[model samples]
Target: MQQKPLTGRLILADVARGLALLTMAIYHFSWDLSWFGVVDWDVSGSPGWRLFAQLIAGSFLFLVGFSLVLAHKSGIRWESFWRREIKVAVAALAVSVATYFIFQDQWVRFGILHSIVVSSLLALPFLRVHYVFALLCGAGVILLYHWLGDYVLPYRQFFWLGLNSLPEVSVDYVPLIPWFGPVLLGIGCGDILHRYDLLRLLRGSASPSVISRCFAWFGRHSLATYLLHQPILFGVVWAGVTAGVLSTNAGDVQVRSFQQSCVMACSQTVDAGVCEQACRCTSSEMMNRGVWEDLLTRPNDADVREIAQQVFQVCLRR
Candidate 1:
């Protein structure tokens, strides 16, 4: 069988990657805003937001699988493959090290880049196998992880496998089980596209629009962009806060946090109206007593526990 030399680039793949990159940037920026207290809503904890994040991550993984198949379809491009892997491995290490300094408690131990490098290697053997087999394996792994959750693993090291419970503070964690599913699926998709000569079709009809070109450029240099975007955003936000351009009203932030937490806990037991009233009472008392600053800044469980006892008694009596 004659193999096609990698002469043409796939616009569709690049565009898809560009879209994922944009989505990730938007999500991360919003998360940064929430962290700075500019946004009262919890981007991380909300169900819809969480799903959006997962979809973005899954899309990127799928693209990784797709790119791998397209690159190695003719034969194993060992030199290029190793070069890309090394680049990704180094980037992953950089992320791990950088995040350790920024967020010492919840550093990215095995983030998206780490998962991709590992999964790429794992998926290599499956490239030569049938696409349907790859698809099935992907599905099975996803399902297996879902089932694995019912059982507990003893070791903390096994957390990267996605079977163990996640750590208390994980900013970005992409485990092997379900995350590998998208990569395998991408491989299958790549195989199907290759078999059908869809790459040629896509390349031939590729758009020459300015927007398309810009996105493609972003896709091409996604690694560099990914590495730099967060630092840039952090600097901008930090600078704004320092310059007093961004609002850092500690009282307002603390009040919202207190209300959100109080209402959430109270609503589980009482009515929404009751919860609202209780939260309002607690908020006012905390603010009046000058304990709000301490709770907001240097909150310990003991302090919270004592405050909760006082608030519960005071609010319940009213």
Candidate 2:
């Protein structure tokens, strides 16, 4: 039998989501700056940036589990559950299609939204299960992935599982593996909260400050914000660059860095002069092919890798 949807929103949860959105924006903005050469480091590839991104993604996924428990605490609301699932699935598809067109080489095939949809579906049975069971399952999943993640799958089709040794070159690539761990943990945590009647207490809590209310508003509309924020941010940055309000030397910087790194690595086996000449030749060829940025930012991209290999061969012969 279908159950009625749960009423009363959790302001604290909304506030948490709102804060996450704010941090996500900051990270994305930094990435945009890195893309525009306003930042000296590779925001997408740097260790600190990568960790920050993971934490943000983890927070969102954790909240997904928590919210699911809160929504279906009494009984499974099949109608509302399916409604939200369908909407999320559609949004995930949109993201995949849009990214495929925009970034053909480094598209997000299964990003955070896609993971959320799958995780939510997989989490259905766990909703009514004991919180400890959910917690153990979550930890098991995480441990399994940690131990076996290095083993490559036989088929490329299963890359979305995050078990393959293939290089990940997407704008966003949140897979099910350990990511589902956070969601399950969230379910366990939410169940604990429900057991202690903390959810009731939270629901009754008021947003005392203006900042809190603003954050709650953002949290409530997070899905809309997520979908719209990147495009708006990218467009604003693009417009500024086009209008000369922002200047960029990212290409030059990338080229110089690539050349220097290449020379340094090559000098280990060859003479310094030969390494310098070869690096220069490779750099020029990369620029001529309009792949200099791709070579640096997406070195593992198929076309970029192929072009680099060919260029290296020619440079070696020269």
Candidate 3:
């Protein structure tokens, strides 16, 4: 038999979300530092950093699924659901628009919020299904993507399906296939919690520490924190750069890093000699034209982007 809907908010979930938010902030700070050349390592490309990012994304998606069950286990609250969905959808659109203007080359078209909007809708039917069935479906989705994720569909619009051979240039690209698996798994877990009345016990438990309480607060306002934290962190780093507290050699470091990454990426499709020559050509040209620093700091600036594109074309012909 099905159990009644669990009453009240789950404190543990909020604390978990708060902790996730904290870790996310830490990761973003590292990314910001790297972007400003304060760090030598590439936070976006490092294996450890990539793994951390994936785990954080998975936790948030899982919570999305779990929260769905918590809110609608008794019955679908259509009004509340629509209200929240519209808000999330709007926020996702705003992110896409904002990133497009800021990072024209690698904007976020389908990031975490976008994924949540789609995955939440897809996960709705699973809420009424058996927990074991939901788990099975989740495993199947993950396995399917693992086995066939490399096959490319021949369209740019299909990139968000996770089945296309698109460049991994987007700031955030959370596709529906494997990512949706986490949501299904979260739903299964939530179902089990309700079945055993575990949520009620968790809700009654007191937060043991002030830190935990703080995390809970952040968790309760996770969306706002997610949206606002990056701009604030970026501003802080930008201010440090303006004040001359950060490294002045950032341009040199950035150029070197770009050459290394470009060669690595180019080598995958061409000979080492060709990759090295092209990257060196592009790097030298940008440096010669005095656009390297501007390109890094103001990637979206029209004049910088135009000059950068011309440099790339010139290098490609060499």
Candidate 4:
């Protein structure tokens, strides 16, 4: 057997990145199922599926930090750094542009890839710092997040600033600020591992046997996988929905279930009651007007804006 090349340093990270990517795919599959009327998106609260998704985001970004440290611990080069930075930055911008076209009503303004790009640049100064310093900075950032999260949500301008407010209209919104705190923590972790050479130890001796090589393969190309999987999943769900295999309207008290789910999911932006009431009201109104299909299959900006306002009014302003 040809001993796998790039197998040493890349080992743990490859596996970790793969697992995170898979988890993210699962989460998005759930979202697509909901979108296609196969199921309701778990928007109810932070209790069940939501917790898993957060864990996935944290893992990926931490890995991003970890990867950065691994990429350049041996040396620093402005040219190489800028080259990698440009690649990531371009991809991030592409994501924003494509999403803006697809979901103009709720396009990702600054999502996970954007975080990775910016956080990588931000992590530069601290790359050579002691783990102790990185730890302290992480703690400070977390504290600041808690202190100011609520205030940031109220100001529309602060949405881009990435604190307090929920991601607007975007399917996946991973902001900076407090979220970056976690990435910083990951950097601290990388520093400790690099300084102590613990990563080598983990690969050689400490890793769980159950993790296996398959999962690691997923980690290696996680970015490409992430980009491709969603469309495939959505296409499947969309076909099912079009074929009437999935029902947009679940009927009777099931509508309440939908409302509850929406309320719980969107409570980050506002209270659950607001979402439930608004969605229920809008759904009911649309049914009465015989325009429920329009709400569900909005093809233009006007329809998106109109239905979004209707949904917003019931959930937010109420």
Candidate 5:
């Protein structure tokens, strides 16, 4: 089944990808809005929202591969692609550097765009390979992150690799190991579509379904929409706060809940009790300082650890 170019099926993929991008924006807006005294969602110190965000990341990356194959269904064309790759790569690096400038304390050293740029560069080699081989590579990349964890696999250097048991000093680092693997899977899937012309069917080649059209439209311009959605969501959330649509009281229950999430995220260093106690005190002080929400939403590792330590002393006195 050979797929036609830019058919209904392609538009469907866009819509799906667009929805996923929108999901990510929703999460970020929820997070950012919480900071400006808007909606008080437990984004930072909560398991559910964290998982939601991870799912969003995984879907986005997977689709990146999916879309890559669909776009270049003919074959890997470096001459036409390299120029754009450099542009996106530079943009990604600029993001890291610029983010560092903005939030020196908790900068995003390697976020989603960085992963896409790196994966795009690395994926060229595997492009012509058999789809099965590509899938195997994807599996290996994801599994290696865990198999090689205990022996210290150069966190600083491979921080982009995402295979660390103890990741450091970053807000949302999507490393290469596991994350890149998805890109490969997407490519494999893309090739499968290309070989069988399944892309058209998936893109709405078979029948022009409304749902298919929606996702495809999204997939086409995911990059732009993803970049723009956050500011708009933030603005809306900000307005909600200003109009008092959302309350501004994240008190003791919130603190205890926050402590639990922080401990779970950081108890890997043989100091659970310390993290626990300090979290309690930090919560107390932060609440007193009227910055409890701030602590939950956008705190750095130093600040996170500092709070953990402060409460740990309470354990010593006890």
Candidate 6:
């Protein structure tokens, strides 16, 4: 029996974030459907869907910037800042661990939460400076990504920086370079909003509609919702598959799934170059020897297992 007027902590910013969350849930649901073979096209891979995802990621990062400024513009709130930072960092670690089990190879190495936490830490220096400086710095970083994209990195370890080209195997990779631009821009926008009293004006005039209230509620509890939504969606899809309500061809699904998972998992232990080659070689060799079915059906078969291992070893050497 918890009841409080929604208007008490309500703000336009919360509703805006809520809307972003709603869209994000929808995007993930669609992606989950594709993963389950409910759809023919890969929602996460399609150009339109990819663009949609970028927009969602951008919006979330922008809000991260905006929220950072809103909380600390008066002066740095060291206590509150660290408290929030710890929560975000912990949630990010949780995501990495969970995804490691669920998606192993393609687990979220440095996904959105990881990026946000790092970006927030990096943005601390700019908080006390002029907004224009942050805006320009952000713009410069974005351009730097484009400029650096043309050069080959001498070392592969720094791929997480997002300045180098790497195999597109990560399930959710949001490198720091271009992505941090939005956050910096958001900080600048926050300054503009505060200086003009925009946030106060928006909050003062907000209508207490049910939709608005619900959105605000979701926005307020965004972190918890973000953590839970994916697992729930995944469970629902798994249930459907178990109930035979949704049918997927085992071979196509399993092969693609295994290859993708293998590359993603392998990438963690090896460079992207080696992982990609090994996975491609392994999957191809399995398919070529007409032993893919045997491997899938009898994973413990000594002969097939030996052949798979040999392929991996050869791939690594090459």
Give the best candidate by lDDT: 3
Provide C-alpha RMSD values for all models, in order.
Answer: 5.9, 7.7, 5.9, 6.6, 5.9, 6.2
| Candidate 3: regions farther than 4 A off | 256-318
Please give the range of 10 consecutive residues that has the lowest summed lDDT in model 3: 267-276
lDDT of each: 0.79, 0.81, 0.82, 0.69, 0.69, 0.79
Against the hidden reference, what TM-scores do the models get? 0.81, 0.79, 0.81, 0.74, 0.75, 0.79
Task: State each candidate's clash count.
Answer: 0, 0, 0, 8, 25, 2
Candidate 4: clashing pairs of residues: 18-219, 43-264, 43-265, 44-264, 44-265, 106-169, 274-315, 278-314
Tens-digit lDDT string for candidate 2 (25-122): 98888777667675566575456888999999999999999989988878888999999999889999999999989867567888999999999999
* Candidate 2 residue pairs that clash: none
TM-score (C-alpha) between model 1 and the true structure: 0.81
What value of lDDT does candidate 1 attain over all alpha carbons?
0.79
The 10-residue segment of model 1 with minimum total lDDT is 161-170
lDDT per residue for candidate 3 within 1-318, as digits (tens), equals 667666667788899899989899999998888877887765765679989999999999989999998889889999999998998998899999999998675689889999999999989999899999998998888898988846556455876667765444567889987899989999999999988877786674564578877888899998888999999999998899889888646564677567666765765455444565787788889888887878788978998878876886678678
Q: Name the runs in model 6 displaced over 4 angstroms.
A: 1-10, 150-152, 204-206, 258-318
Model 4, 109-184: lDDT tens digits are 7888888888888888777888788878877876887777455555667665565454354556776766677777
lDDT by residue (tens digit), candidate 1, 20-71: 8999999888877777777666676667888999999999999999999888
> Which parts of model 4 are misplaced by more than 4 Å?
1-7, 41-47, 153-157, 163-167, 204-211, 243-318
Show the colliding residue pairs in model 1: none
